[model samples]
Target: MDILQFEKQYLRLPSAIDEIHDELFDQKGIRVFVKRDDLIHPIISGNKWRKLREYIQIAQFNGYKHLISFGGAYSNHLYALAFAAKELGLASTGIIRGDELTSQSNLYLSQMESWGMNLKFISRTNYQKKLIPKEIDTTNSMIIAEGGYGKMAIKGVSYITKEINQGNFEHIICPIGTGTTYLGLCESTNNIEVHGILTLNNLKEIESNALEVGIPIQRIYDAYIFGKYAKQPEELVNFCQLFEQKHQIKIEPIYTGRMFYGLYDLIRKDKFKPESNILALHTGGLKS
Candidate 1:
């Protein structure tokens, strides 16, 4: 399947970096800009949209009756996949990672199920094993890695370089989960430095993964893990709420919020020079 063909079906989101000019510079005392990939698509927005678009196209072209993927209960990827699959007339099965379900998380899960996505819950141990269920057909059905963080996920991230070229930013920073997005940006550019503010505590593993990509990543800052992925502290939540109030841009506590927090800290520690034009890629997953 030609990924370029489906590009026309989706509306390209306009960059929203202009709106936060004052807050990013004057209020934060840092020359920060944003690559608003969050607005890429209304239904399947942000990095997930970019990563999944081609995979969905491939599945359709291969005549897949069902699309099976992996994610957690509150996975933005799973949610977006459910919506995109319904739109493309394909059946979706989401293999969720955890067992715990709060009221809010369950509500979103119910919505995805209502949208015709088959929801399957597995033991956390099994989820960590990263085993693909045998019942699902791997021939025609495309299995998108959880969080879409593999090499295949880099396709969506390659678009970031085009945006950077247009803006002429000196550096790019993004929240790091599986490192696919950061690696994509690193591969797409030469001179610009790409930083990934890791949300996970185990920096060595993520750093190793980044190195495995064989791309020049400027740095990986794991100082603000906020007690691991999806586990947020009061300060992190408060910071996210305050940022939303100030910028009116809602950021998820796990990823973007931590990156923003780290960016602020870096500025406070005199890490970023005032003259440096830094671009922060808002790889939005706030809804999840």
Candidate 2:
């Protein structure tokens, strides 16, 4: 599909899915289906699009001319909102973490700015304390919480729950960065087991983020975090390369790759019985 056609259609619908025919999973007595939310749109793909769709609509409908949000250097949230805002003809400003970046810090930031997102750099401490509290100037502006995980996004993320409810899957698994999508999925289900895989070194802080969404964690796998957030150690890189080659599904180290790796680990341990059907969400932050 062309970019414009897909973008316009995605705002009104959920992304498609693909079923992998890997014999390893089949021999292990498990069925794996990937919810390809990553293919929703190139820039505003996956959970980022789900998290930002309604916020952007509310911004425009509420008569706001500008949207201000916070994120790190390669945040998918900022990258998505920048392009979505531009598509909707609304102005956007990204309060980026760290005051150490030049105009050419990286390609993601550069694309954000090129798409009409005004960049504002702040120290990490201030970014955590001030901007995270939504203290940005609000003159005709909508203040988006970090990672676009505020209440506004819960509705969109719940779409996953709705889809999963319609499927025969016994368990749902997703990568947990800030736990927004996990919570959204959790809020709409009662019986299905939801597994969240950590992609950062922070277990306690990640738990807190999950709690902020009011989702009680049962099992969160953190063994595959590699080292820290955004750190692409050799193992993770090599694993992603091999997995993509076999599955033909594109994934990055920061999120989906870790989740898939962790999923295979659990399967190898015989954690799921032959009666179990699993759905892994491709949450999509490869652009980051």
For this target, which candidate reaches the highest TM-score against the unseen true structure? 2
lDDT of each: 0.76, 0.81
TM-scores of the candidates in the order shown: 0.87, 0.90
Report the C-alpha lDDT of model 2 over 215-269, residue by residue, as the tens digit. 6776678888887887988888888999899989989988988999899899988
lDDT of 1 at 133: 62
Listed per model in order, the count of residue pairs whose N, CA or C atoms clash below 3 Å is 0, 0
Residue 264 error for model 1, in Å? 0.9
lDDT of 1: 0.76
lDDT string, candidate 1, 1-288, tens digits? 244544555647444564365544664455667778777776577788767866776677778767788888878888888987887788888888875653246777888998898877777898898776666556667777888766767866776676556446767889888778878888887778777898887667666876787765678887898777889889999999998898778787888999889987887777776677788888788564
